[model samples]
Target: MPAAKSDSPGRVRRIARLIFRVCLFGGLAAIATLVVAVLVTMASLPSFADMMQKPNGQTVRVHASDGSLLLSLGPSYGDWLPYDRIPAEMRNAIVAVEDRRFYSHPGVDPIGVARMFYVAKRLHDEGRRLQGGSTITQQIARNIFLSSKYSYGRKIREAILALAMERKFSKAQILELYLNRVYFGGGAYGIDAASRKFFGHPGDKLNLAEAAIIAGLVKAPSHYSPSADAQAARDRASVVLDVMVDAGTLTPAQAKGVNLDSVTFAPEPKQNSVRYFTDWALSQLDTIVDEQAAPLDVWTTLDKRMQDAADASIRQNTPKDLQGALVSMENDGAVRAMVGGTDYVTSIYNRATQAQRQPGSAFKLFVYLSALEAGVKPGDPVVDEPITIDNWSPRNSSRRFLGPIDVRTAFAFSINTVAAKIGQQVGFDSVADMAHRFGITTQINTHPSMVLGTSDVRLIELTRAFAAISANGNAVTPYGILKVSTTDGTVIYQREAVQPRVLVAPFVAAEMTDLLQTAVNVGTARAAQIGRPVAGKTGTTSSNKDGWFLGFSSGLTTGVWMGRDDAKPIPGLQGGRNPAQAFSAFMRVALQTRPAEKFATDPTLPEWQLEPDDEAYFGNPDQGFGGDGAPAPEAQDEVTGEVPDVQPAPGDVPPPADTPAAPPRAETPAEPQLDQRWLDNVLRDQKRPPQSPPRGN
Candidate 1:
């Protein structure tokens, strides 16, 4: 029995020694594997300089013409602040709230990591998110060299990189790098940028309360942003102050005395309409300048007051269910104000620049301009009788044809038949060319109905065409970017002041302006007259699906469009009613400070005297086409799916007498008489009877 007991003790000791040897080898293997992993990760990293560079490329800061900040595009990084430049309060607050043992730890805090895992496991048991355990130096390592991917391998690499950073950089250097690289809410990337964005100053000027508020954002930037919710930010700041007190950086009394209420935030703009302009301006940057690695300051032509005025006009005039867009530019094509929709936040679609809706009768400007360019005199007689071409007949909005009216009267009343006749005479291709020459970039359909604006057009381009007329025949290319420079004002791109291309002869433009003036003064666009010499055109599509008004006064040309996004009709909607009133309202405020200017009149062209027959046919200007003192409705152009209600003609009305006498004005020269026989022959051809359909077999 004694011999068996001794053998058992010896066997137990052998088993203990064998287990110890196995554990020792396993520990050694683990150490060797860790060393290999560290080496491989180190070799894969880029150089430190490359690592410290901003991850997202360059930022672009757009400014208005008056030097006011419109908005920042991309991540905005301010000038880097040295350790001395960073306020003590900001540094202490950041260290206290983010990592209390930052100064004492060797890059990675073991205690912090252990506490994080414990808390994370407890939170996981309760069905919550896992908590982060990133020290200040570890955070710097992850931000610079790695991404926020969760894995033990990533954590190990982060710790190793943090150790390497600590070995290379001083404590102050590490803190400075952290302060300069951290992201704050509102697109600010650094302490100085956050300070300037939130408090309108630099980081060196931050007080205790401001520092606490900014530091609190390091946890959840969007949630604790002061601009987003001031009270929540203040409460977060209080928590940061409490942490500072616990860390012994500030006394309890000192923390209590820091008045977060006294921290005043920078005032935000009242209107977000400017974002639409900024978005458009940003799109042009790549085309203007080469790909830039450094930040750019883009100065645009947006006028804040004019934008506000436009927003107010649209909100007040546009109906609740419908949407409206407006674009205004100088005679030289510097876009001043643009409102894409009623609210930019809900819809980012820039209707003024993006949407291509039918311009309706407002497009007649191009048709008439084409006619004038073809040597058709405004005073020449044209028949407004019913006409059909290619089995398609167009009717006037009034449904009553004024027989043998002068070209000016027909255009002023938006006579669809006369416009179609003029379009055919001038050639639809010629009208399309005229629109293109005036800056329309969209494709134009050349169907017979296209003369009445069947082809869809953008509001911005349409406004630019009118601006060309307002600028005395000079072609305008709409531009918003005035200059693009570096942060230190190094000029990268500046729009060179060049004389505009002359698209039309001054006399032709003058003639067109005369027709437009008649449109606003005595025709369908009478609602757009702002007690000044305003010239504009009104257009309404079939069933009132789209309403539009394009006008110009002083040195500005503005266009307004109102419609449903789905192209559905609005009840009782007409271009002359709402769109014209909106234009007038906006222009009144836009041109309030500027002097009223008269449209250029061609003295060479003679004014036609009213004949007795013509006078009876054309009623009072204010009473409109009905001659009952009721305002004329907008001209509705025919489109697909719309059928014209053609009423039976009363009888064939005879042509008016040829060659009316010319009235004399003090400023006008002696007028040359037009060839009446040529004019009559042209009118007769336009008034030809329609061909009858062949009998069915």
Candidate 2:
């Protein structure tokens, strides 16, 4: 008792004063720290009042040429909404579940703050994570202005910013900001977008049931959203309705009537085929107008029916590993259909628009066209006879020559020897020039092998060349966009129809068609017959790596290419098999309803006489043309391949796998001179072509 007694009243008083001074100092330091923190948070914020007038996310839509929607690209982050535009049900449901005393609070709810402190203490004691109890104002402050980090400092900043934002904006504006800027679910930011995305209707159209469902999503959009889980979303919606009924926003009877099971859900998006075409057309947009100037309304030239046909044909005809491409354009060069690949999901590489592959024997068309231009008649006698040009000795694909076959016959058979000779006789310059004038922008190889289609080229250019022939020599550059307008219907860019430049004379094209029709009727491309006269060529590259069937009908021209992406050889796939069959199938489907029109050409051959097996390839080209049946220039004597010695039946016709491949060049002291000398002598011998071995020998 004596030890517990106070030493003195004066000493106790001194101790009390010391303690008071220390407490006062500590309080002052804490106040100063809080003041500094408030200042720093104010410094970090932007002018919130001015930010209201600026735009939020903007969406860009792409449409097919037919005005059907393809896809939307953009700032799909969220769509903006005004306070008045929000439905009462949606707004009340949110307030009831998220913050009941939102209107009465200054910037933060003191009751919520105390509850969070209790939660923080209990969670810390349990070694678990703390949970948020933020008011709507504080949430808006954090999402719109402050970083989402949760720390003592960040919490302090959030409170300061919330108070500041509340003072600057009205309660209604703050609520509008919260509802529009808050993350709802499924990449949606705001009740407006969430409502539209999940219900397929606007936010203002939301009913009590929909509003409760959307409000429930605010807590965990991905977990509770109907798009992800139906049962979870319904459970959450029920909880939200209970909260609403407790808050007096909904009566018990109303809550009972609001069932999530009866609400309609949005349907899944339909698949789009025009995505690739629109992508390309948009790129071309940069050249003419800035699509950024306004929301664009692009109209393309894609024919939905033909596009589907092309896609279906590629899938059914080509192997899974071997990719294929098809591009079809009208004679005037308007791209009507394009199938970029079998499946755009696995690959976005537009083979029709972007891939460049060797056209193989397809290039021979250009070579023969040059020969035709140089006054070589379609019936002109050309030797399939094997002859050595220095080290480059060319042989026919049959490995056995048909002796002196006419140009029309050689072309129908895709004979390599005669093609190489034709390219040699005309000089490679004329062939290259013809290609350039016809819209082949890619560089052409000047070698003699160019005639055999050894060089790489895009399918578009090759298709364009064939289009020119179909148009009777009118040059065409493939174009897709027909018109581009703004959302207000003001035309930003309009493509006017203009007559194209002519590349070949009308008669030359007709003569070329006359020969090509024979190819489809009785030659290597017999598989491509569509019950009409189709003019085209079949091209198989060396090693069977690339096969092509580039052909045209009366008004439509189509090109198809098939090959491995790695350029490896395909087994037993020649131009006559897969490519030809695909081309025919695609054409049949594409023009199934359109009336069949014969090709517009003079001097056409009769279909019944020249059956696929008809040995009467003996009917002269000049005779069928109803022309001054000019005597074909004689072909000079040369060792073509070994003559088969006897006529083989039509079924025994060997595929001209390689128009004669260039045998290795012979080594000679005067190799270049010999090359020049052979070229010079080819045309001279054209008038005296070696006579064919007697038919049926």
TM-score (C-alpha, index-matched) for candidate 1? 0.69
TM-score for each of the candidates: 0.69, 0.63
* 170-239 per-residue lDDT for model 2 (tens digits): 8888888888777777667777678777888877788999988988988887899888787898899999
Candidate number achieving the greatest lDDT relative to the actual structure: 1
Which runs of model 1 end up more than 4 angstroms from their true locations?
A: 1-61, 68-104, 109-134, 141-161, 168-180, 190-271, 291-293, 592-595, 602-697
Q: Estimate candidate 2's alpha-carbon lDDT, on a 0 to 1 scale.
A: 0.70
Best by TM-score: 1
lDDT of each residue in 161-250, candidate 1, tens digit only: 886676667788889889988888888888998989889988889999999999999999999998899899999999999999999999
User: Cα RMSD to native, each candidate?
Assistant: 10.9, 12.4
